[model samples]
Target: MITFDQVTVRYEDTAEPVLRGVDLTVEEGELCLVVGHTGVGKSTLLGAVNGLVPHFTGGTLYGRVVVDGRDTADHPPRELADVVGVVGQDPLDGFVTDTVEEELAYSMEQLAVPPATMRKRVEETLDLLGLADLRHRALHELSGGQQQRVAIGSVLTAHPRVLVLDEPTSALDPTAAEEVLAAVTRLVHDLGVTVLLAEHRLERVVQYADRVIHLPGDGRVVSGTPAEVFRSSSIAPPIVELGRAVGWSPLPLSIRDARRAAAPLRAALSAAVPPPVRPVPGGDRPELLTARGVTVAYQGVPAVREVDLTLHGGEVTALMGRNGSGKSSLLWALQGSGPRKAGTVAVSSDGPKSKDPRKLSAAQARQLVGLVPQTPTDLLYLESVAQELDQADTESGVAADGVRARTILDRLAPGIPDTTHPRDLSEGQKLALVLAVQLTAAPRVLLLDEPTRGLDYRAKSELVRIVDGLAAEGRAVVISTHDVEFVARAADRVVVMAEGDVVADGPTTEVIVASPVFAPQTAKILSPLPYLTVAQVAATLPADETDPDS
Candidate 1:
C-alpha cells in the first residue's frame, strides 16, 4: 500500500512544483493506471512512490509520502527496494548487464538471495515474461520489445510487493505491448502485487486498471474508477468513445466487449445497408531508393546479406520482422550511416555518387534525406519548443521560420505546445515536435524509425495522417514500425526483412493479410475485402431493399 498526503515536488531552482498538493492512496492488490496529456507530471508521480523524485532528481518536497508503511523521505530507493520495483520507458538506458538471464538475476544477487533461490527465480521470471526463447540473447541483440520485457523481468526478480512502471509499453508494438500488459495483469490477478503504471497509450491499459488517475498539466490529481474518471476527463479509450456513441451502460472496457456491443448495431445497420468492399491499392511503382546485392557486416559477422529492395515515392512502406531480423541495420545502411560492401544503393533524384548519402558532402547530404531517429530526445537540444522549430526552419531554407513552424505545430496541436520546454513535454509530444521539424527540411526521402512506438491511439492517428499527406505530396516515406493497425491504415506497400535478407514484398494489403507472423487488425481479418476505416465500411453496405433476408 502507498499513500501521498498533500505531496508536492519541485525540481531544483524550478518555480512551479511538478506535483501540486497530491493526496492519493494505492492499496494492495490494486492496479492503478495514470493517464494525461504531455507534461502533466506522470513520470514525477511515479518517482514519488520509488523515492526517485527528491533523491535522484534533487528537488524540493512538501508533505508526507508513504509507501509500504515507510515514509519516502525516510527510505531511499535502495532501502525501498524490497517494497517497490521501478521500470522506466527506455530499456537500453536501464540495462545493467550484458545478457538477458544475467540482467534478470542481478537484482536477486544484490539482495543476497541464495544462489539456488536466485537460479529458480531467474528461470521462473523468464518463463513468466516469455523470455525463455531469448534467455541466451545478448542485451544489445534483443528487439525493443524483448529488451523491455527483460527490463521488467529484472525488476520483478526482486519480488517487490509494488510494481511501478513509467510508460512500460512505450517502446512496444501492439502485440508486444499486449504481451507485457497481460503479464502485468497476471501479477495483479495471480500474484496480488499492487501495480501503479503511467503511460500515454490509455486504450491498451485503461481497461485492465481498477482505478484511473489523471494528472493534467495544471498540477492536480483527478482520481476515480476508470469509467467515472474518464467520463469526466477529455481523454479515454476508443471503446469508451464507441460506448458513448452506442449508449452502452458502464462503457465497453475492452475491444472484445466493444465488438459484442457492435454486433447488434452492425446487424441493424447492415440490414438497412450492405458493407462496401474496396479493392487493394495498385502495386508499387518504380523504386525511389533501391538496394541491389547489398551486404553489410559488423565486427566480422554479416548483418545484412545480399539483398535487393526498392522504395517508391508517393508511397508508405514498412520494414518488419522478429528481433535480430536486421530491420534496423538495413535502415541504417539506407541512411548512409553504415558500411556498404558488395552492392549499390541508388536514389531516383539526380545527384552525384559523392553527393549520395553514402559518400556525400555534408551540405549535399542535408539536401537529400531527413531522418527521425528512434529516440525522440537524442536529437533535441534546444531550450524551448519555439527555438527548436525556428532553428530547423532556418536550416531548411524552404519557408520563413514563423510561417513553417506555426503551420506544422497547429496541425499537430492539442498535444504539443510551441512555447513549452522540449524536455517538459511527454515522450509522444517530444517525438512529434522533432518530426515536425524534420518535415520542414523538404527532403526527397524521409526515414522514420519506429514512429508510433510510444504514442497513444490519437497521437498515432495524427502521425499516420501526416505521413499519408506527405506521401500524397510525392515524397518517399519509409517507416520502420511494428504497429499493425498503423500499417494497415497508412501503408501502400510492405517489405518484410528477416535475418538481414529481404524475405517478402508486395502491396500493403497483400503483405499484411498474407503474412502468418505479422498479425493484421481484427476488422481487416474479419472482412474479406480491404477495409481500413469505419467510414469506409459505412459507405459500402448495400441498401435494405437489395436483400429480402434483411
Candidate 2:
C-alpha cells in the first residue's frame, strides 16, 4: 500500500536530508510503526506518504514515494486525499470547521461526496472512535484528548484507504489512548485499512504493530518485526528494556511475555527492599510557595476548587489526572495567569509575598515561578534559535555575552545549529529550546506542563536527569503529565486530580503502584514489590558471578 524508493527528503536550510535512502514497501492492511529519537525524520517520513513533504513543506524530494501506486511526486496532498489521510502531532492545527460534526463532514464535502453518504460516514466514524458524545461540542472548547479523537474522526470519515498518524495518542490519558489504539487496530483487521504511524510511546502500540521502522536520527530507516527491532534499538519501552537488562531470551515485546520471564526476577526482587518512600513534610524543607483555598472558575464554572498546596525546596512533584481534570488549569492558576475565583497564593521570594500572581509584573512573576507549557513552541517567537537564546538572556537580565542559555539547550539536545530557525527545528528540538528559554529565568519554582509530549526515550531520560539535578539544586519542580513512565522515573511525589479536585497525593510508589491506571510498565510486571522503574529493578538484582567449577 505504501512504498518508498530511494526517497531522500532535504530542506534548503540544513545540509543534511531529513530522510535519506529510505526504501520500503508496506503491504496493505499492515499497521507499520516508525520509531526514533526526537528530530529524526519520523515526521518528515510521515509527510512523504501523502505528498506533504516537498509539496506542502517546500522541501526537495530525491526519489519517488508511491501510495496505492500513485506517485506522491505526481500527486499533491489534496489529490491523494481519498487515498491517504494524515493526522499531525497537534490536532488543533488540522481542524477546518468549528464543531466536531462539521469537521468530520467537511472533508467529505471537499471530496464532493453525496450528502447522505457523508452524513452516514460521519456518524459511523464518530461512533467508531467514541466521539458520539462530543459531536456537537465546538472544536476549540474540547480537551486535548477530545481534540485528538476529533482529528482522527475527521480523517476516518473520508474513508481513505491509508492513514498516516503522528503521535496520535500523545495527548490522551491511558484509557483514551488505549481506546484510540484499539480503534486504529480495528481498522487494519476489520476494514483492511493500511496505517503508517509514528509514536514515542512504544508501550502503548508495540504489541499491536505488524512491523517496526526505526529512524536513528541520522536519515536512516531500519525496518523489521517489533521483536527484531527492539532487541537492540536504543529507543525501546520499559518492557523490552527490562528483558534486555535481565537477559531474557527472545526479548519480550509486550507485558504478557515479560511477566512469564519476570517470575524469577520478581521472586528475587521480593527479597530486596524497595527504596523507601520518604514523606516530605512542610517543615522538613523550605516552603517556596503555599496556596490555600485556591479556586479557578471559567464562566461561573469551577475548574479548580479550594485546593491547598505547598511546594518545597529540593522536590519534584508530578500532577496527574484525566484530560478535563483541571491539570493544565491548576498549573496556569498556580502560575498566576489563569482565572482564580477564590484563594490565597503566596511565594517565598527573598522574604514572603502573599499577593495574587496575576498582580505581579511578568518579570516579577518569572523570578518567583517559571512555566514551560504543553505547547513549548508558544514560548518562542524569535526568528532563529540563537536569537531566542539571546533574547532569553536579555529578558532574564543575564550578561550580554552569557552562554548559560545556550549551554542549557546543548545539554538537552546537542548538535542543533545556532542559525536554525525555531520553527524549522523538529518537535523535540523545539521543546528543548523552549525548556532552555524558560530555565534562563532561574525561578524558585519551575512548572513543566506535559513536558514529555514529544520527547523520545533518550530525551525523556535526559529530562529526568535535568529535573533531578534542578531539585538537587534546591529548586522546587512541578510537572503535569500523563506519561506515567516518565513520572515514575522523574517525580518524587504524585498528585492525582479528578473532576477538578485533588483525589490523591502521596509518594510516587504509594500513589501510582496502588492505582492500576497510573502504574508504569515495570510496576505492572513486578507487582507486590513496590518497584516503579526498570533502573530500580536493575539495582536490586545480584550480578552474575564466575562459577568455581568452570
Q: What is candidate 2's lDDT per residue for 1-550, written digit by digit as tens?
A: 8999999999887889988998999999999999998877888899999988989889799989998889988898989999999899988888888999999999899999999999899889888888888889899878777899899889988888999999998989898899889999999999899999999988889999999999987898999998899877878888888887887778787788888878988877787887533333334578888988889887787889889999999899999998889888888888998788888888777755455567899888888888998777788898899999988988888775654788888877888899988988777788899988988887889999888888888878788877877787788999999999998888889999998899999988789999989999999998877888877776667666111211
Model 1: ten consecutive residues of lowest lDDT? 541-550
Can you give the TM-score per candidate against the true fold?
Answer: 0.84, 0.95
Local distance difference test scores for all models: 0.75, 0.86
Q: State the lDDT of candidate 1 residue by residue for 1-550, as single tens digits.
A: 9999999988764567888999998889999999876556788899889888788877888999898899989889999988899998778878888999999999888788999999998999998878999888899877677888899999999888999998887666666678889989999999899999988767668879999998866778999999888665766655565455445667667766766666655654543443322233345654578778888887777878998877777877887766567777777777777677678777666744323478776555656667777777887999988899888888887544334854665565453546678876656677778787888876778888887765656666677778877776677888887766567666777888777888888877678776544545335223344444444443454443122221
Which one wins on lDDT? 2
Clashing pairs in 1: 274-541, 274-542, 275-540, 275-541, 276-540, 276-541
Off by over 4 Å in 1: 11-17, 133-137, 268-286, 297-305, 350-356, 381-390, 401-426, 501-504, 507-530, 534-550
Model 1 TM-score is: 0.84
- Steric clashes per prediction: 6, 0
